[model samples]
Target: MTQGLKIVIVEDDALIAMDLADLLIGMGHDVCAIASTESEAIVTARRCKPDLMIVDGGLQEGNGIDAMRRIATEGFIPHLFVTGDPQRLAQGAPDAVIVGKPFTMRELSRGIAAALASGVPASAD
Candidate 1:
């Protein structure tokens, strides 16, 4: 409903990454970059400085939560974690917005809204 956001997606699965990119584009948001690993995610975030990040909680090469924690050192960026184990993140980060795996577009949208609304500007660690 607001202006389209610049987003970076941190997902390891190639198909999932493409799907998410397409979905975001269709939703009027810009998909600046897609990162398949934690290092890539960190670098991409720094280079793109996206308005938001949709990160997979468990990456093939590294952990998404670790990537986010490292990225947060630079500054807080609104983010939503997509994970199969939502309870883990919820318990660790009660204030953070998280969406479980096999999520619906509606769920993703709500998580994005909540993350942006939070706007705490603090490290996600």
Candidate 2:
């Protein structure tokens, strides 16, 4: 509605990934990439240079914390943690605004708004 963000989604579950992508599109954001693994997430993030990343806290390989640890080093890209276990993500990514999984699109939208306003995911270092 306002100006959509270029976004990337790092999620392992294929159905969940598609749902997220749809939600982003409904919100008028462009989904640059959708990755299911840490390596893929990193590679796609670099290639896409997205304005924001909505990442699952856990993945089959390395998890979002691991991916963000690396992404942070390259500089800041705002990120939101969408996962079931908020506590786990909070411990790993204190600066991120986490949204637990099974969340409503409205709730996820709120989290996105907050993260965008926050600006720049904090460096893991």
Candidate 3:
């Protein structure tokens, strides 16, 4: 798929993660890893150095923001937050790109592009 953006998916639900993986692959992006908890996400991100991460707003063990914060220490790893509750994350990460849950493929794509274009998550829409 032309060495598309290497992405890490951080979601607590297995079914959701699987669906996300399929979506990313269909979009020609590479899913380097899938993590279900904050700790797993941080660890995977540190090891993989993916181009970007798609993180859930609320995670299993901890939270997405905290995990992303730790992961970003290595460098500017852009992120797209997908959650039913966007308001909470917006306060913690004002400029971070986000898409509400039940996002259409178009919305997710736009968020990804916006986050990558800025090299740090940017305001989407």
- Model 1, 1-125: lDDT tens digits are 54599999999999988998998899999999999999999999999999999999889999777888888889888998898998886765666688998889889889889888987532354
Clashes per candidate (backbone, < 3 Å):
0, 0, 0
State the TM-score for model 2: 0.92
For candidate 2, write residues 1-125 as lDDT tens digits: 34589999999999999988998898889998999999998999899999999999999888998897788788677888899999877887787889997899778888888888887564374
Candidate 3 TM-score, C-alpha based: 0.90
Against the unseen true structure, what C-alpha lDDT does each candidate score?
0.86, 0.86, 0.85
Tens digit of per-residue lDDT, candidate 3, span 8-122: 9999999999999999999999999999999999899888889889999898699888887777665668888999888878988887888999999889988888877767633
Q: Candidate 1 at residue 30, lDDT?
A: 95
Itemize residue pairs with steric clashes in candidate 2: none
Rank all candidate structures by their TM-score, best first, as comma-separated numbers. 2, 1, 3
TM-score of each: 0.91, 0.92, 0.90
Q: Is candidate 2 or candidate 3 better by TM-score?
A: 2
In Å, residue 69's CA in model 2 sits off its true spot by: 1.7
List the pairs of residues colliding in candidate 1: none
**Candidate 1 TM-score, C-alpha based:** 0.91
